[model samples]
Target: MNDDVTCISCPLGCRIHVEKKGDRITVVGHMCKKGEEYAIQEVKDPRRVLTTTVKIEGGRQCLLPVRSEKQIPKDLVKKCVIELSKIGIKAPIKCGDLVYKNILETGANIIATRDVESVEKK
Candidate 1:
């Protein structure tokens, strides 16, 4: 089963035609090196990085920057985002701090992409 997909690998956004017969696959309409690999992997397995905010204490509001340590399953991104929304982080966070451990069992943790300092109250 093959499907056509537009390549977002670059600004060109080339329209790709993919055909699969038995175990073989063919593709066309790619204009860059990134798109060729993208088409091959798209026909194989598609993955995307997850980025979202998590609850933080002592910040301007109550949220901190968070992201997956590595790209998890693309299908799992929504589930992960839902779960991440439930996470609450205490303030004075460090960059690269482990925010959530073994999230989705991807052997990856949601980490603090930036430090959120405690807001001094007047």
Candidate 2:
């Protein structure tokens, strides 16, 4: 199988061509080592940092912005979001607070991106 991948490892976006045959792989068109590494890993296993909003109770906003501390498997992004959607957290939440830990056993923690102050009680 032959595939083209755009390298996102640096400012220069090199279009890398990768060819996989049985157990052998060949990469071309990369300008740097980072690009080459990116192409290889992208083809083998892709990962991405997840960022989304979740339900927040008694806060300045109706939703709290959250993100994974590290990149998780790209395939599990949707599942992570679906799980988060079912959770509602109470404020006040500080930035960098741990919202969820080891999400889906991907070794990535969901953390609050911004502070959410608690609303005054009536």
Candidate 3:
């Protein structure tokens, strides 16, 4: 099988051609080592950092921004989003605070991206 991939490891978006025969794989059109590695890994397993909003209770804002601390498997993104939707956090959250730990056992932490102050009651 032959596949074409664009390298995102650096500013140079190298269009790499990957050819897989049995267990052997050949990559071409990459200028750097990182590009070559990226092509191979992308073909095998792709990952991405998730950024989304979570429900916040008693905050100035209705929702709080959150993101995965590290990249997780692409396939689990939808499930993670669903899990986040079911959760509700309190107000007064600071940036970098842990929202969810070891999410789906992928070893990725969902952290708050911004500060949310608590709402004062009259």
Candidate 4:
């Protein structure tokens, strides 16, 4: 199978072509080593940092911005969001506060991205 992937490892955003045949893989069209590495890993196992909003109670806003502590499997992103959608947290929440730990057993914690003051505090 041959695939073209845009490398995000650097600012250049090199268009990388990856070819997989049985047990062998070849990467081309990368301008740097990081691009090459990204292409290989992207083809084998793609990962992405998850960023989304969750329900927040009694806060300045009805939603709280959150993100995965690290990149999780790309395939699990939707599942993680679905799980988070079912959760509701109370404010005031501080930035960097741990919202959810070991989310879906991906070893990535969902952390608050910004502070949300309680409505009563306002």
> Candidate 2: minimum summed lDDT over ten consecutive residues — where?
113-122
Which residue segments of model 4 deviate by more than 4 Å?
19-26
- How far is 122's C-alpha from truth in model 4 (Å)? 2.3
Question: Candidate 2 — which residues are off by over 4 angstroms?
Answer: 9-12, 20-26
Q: What lDDT tens digits, residue by residue, belong to model 1 across residues 39-76?
A: 87777788677899998988766788888887687789
- Top model number, lDDT: 4
Q: Is candidate 1 or candidate 3 better by TM-score?
A: 3
Ranked by TM-score, top first: 4, 3, 2, 1
Residues 9-122 of candidate 3 have per-residue lDDT tens digits of 878899999999999999999999988888998888888788889999989999999999998998999999999999999998999999999999999999999999998832
lDDT of each: 0.82, 0.93, 0.93, 0.95
> Could you give candidate 4's per-residue lDDT for residues 11-119 as a string of tens digits?
8889999999999999999998888888998998999999999999999999999999998999999999999999999999999999999999999999999999998
**For candidate 2, lDDT tens digit of each residue in 28-98?**
99998888888998999988889999999999889999999998999999999999999999999999999
Ranking by lDDT: 4, 2, 3, 1
RMSD of each: 2.4, 2.7, 2.6, 2.1
TM-scores for the candidates: 0.80, 0.82, 0.82, 0.84
lDDT of 4: 0.95
Best by TM-score: 4
Say which prediction, candidate 1 or candidate 3, comes out ahead on lDDT.
Answer: 3
Clashes of each: 0, 0, 0, 0
lDDT score, residue 108, model 3? 100
